[model samples]
Target: MQRVIVRSSRGALPTAAKLVAGIGLALTGFFTASAILPYLPAGTRDQGAGLMSMSFGWLIGWRVIGRAPQATMAGAARVGLRAALWLALTVLLYLGALQMMARMLRGRYHGLSEALTDVIAQGLGLGAAAVQLDVIAMLFLGGVLSAILSAWAARRWQ
Candidate 1:
């Protein structure tokens, strides 16, 4: 075998860390907003949380992914798409995890012989609950804000 050298992209940790941070902020923000805006609709609270978190993710992705803000308009669109895609993927995974946890809590499907259809149906149902427009829109906006804020933070600190 030929000699091989392996190196990992340096941005991976920052990207993952930022994703976790953004998720935490979204959850905390939702709870805080729920308490502060007692009369706010559940949907509105969820939208606000998504907006805040996604904007943060956008900034994080900007810094981690090297899509500079000074690029052409098309470049900016690509950056936005990148962050949005990340969010979509994350949402799917998270929903799937939640579905699995819910099933475990019910103590069902513990056998190897269990039909895969049951699992797929459960996952799909949870996924459907997660794909609201307001949620998607806020996630996009949050991603945009993340791009802006991450750029600003990098400028200030680095």
Candidate 2:
């Protein structure tokens, strides 16, 4: 007789699809809170939050698709195309999600039009400059700090 059993990979996902989805969610949250939140006023927090969430999804697309492991030109091109498609889809979904969330949180925003305008204006004003700087800084800091800490933690944990 043959028996079947399912094995767990703990918190890890085996497939690329699952891994990308998980990374998208995590990066969205991290980018929103750590990078985008502080730049916005309280009333416009939701808008910034939404946009940041979307941006992270695109970032994940770039990471997964555009920056695949070094390989043949054809393989690289395929990965690039896939990444671009995923990035575009992620942006669209993010916008849709933001709109839905805005409707759900209608009461929280005093006026949709005015709040949106303010959000857009603020976004435009600091979007290109401050946000980019923040992203770069955060990436640098997080990369270095995490690497050091991860090494330390691994040694200790082992």
Model 1 clash pairs are 54-142, 54-143, 55-142, 55-143, 55-146, 58-146, 58-147, 59-146, 59-147
TM-score of every prediction relative to native:
0.48, 0.34
lDDT of 2: 0.44
Instruction: Quote model 2's TM-score.
Output: 0.34
lDDT tens readout by residue for model 1, 1-158: 89999887755444433444354334432432233233232322133434543454445453533434423445444555566556555544433444555556678776644534555554455445555666555555555544444444445544
Writing each residue's lDDT as its tens digit, candidate 2 over 30-134 gives 553456445544444345555554566445543553233223445434443444344434433444455445644666456657556544544454443335566
Worst 10 residues of 1 by lDDT: 36-45
Error of 1 at 139 (Å): 0.8
lDDT of 1 at 111: 68
Give the range of the ten consecutive residues with the poorest summed lDDT in model 2: 142-151
lDDT (0 to 1) per candidate: 0.46, 0.44
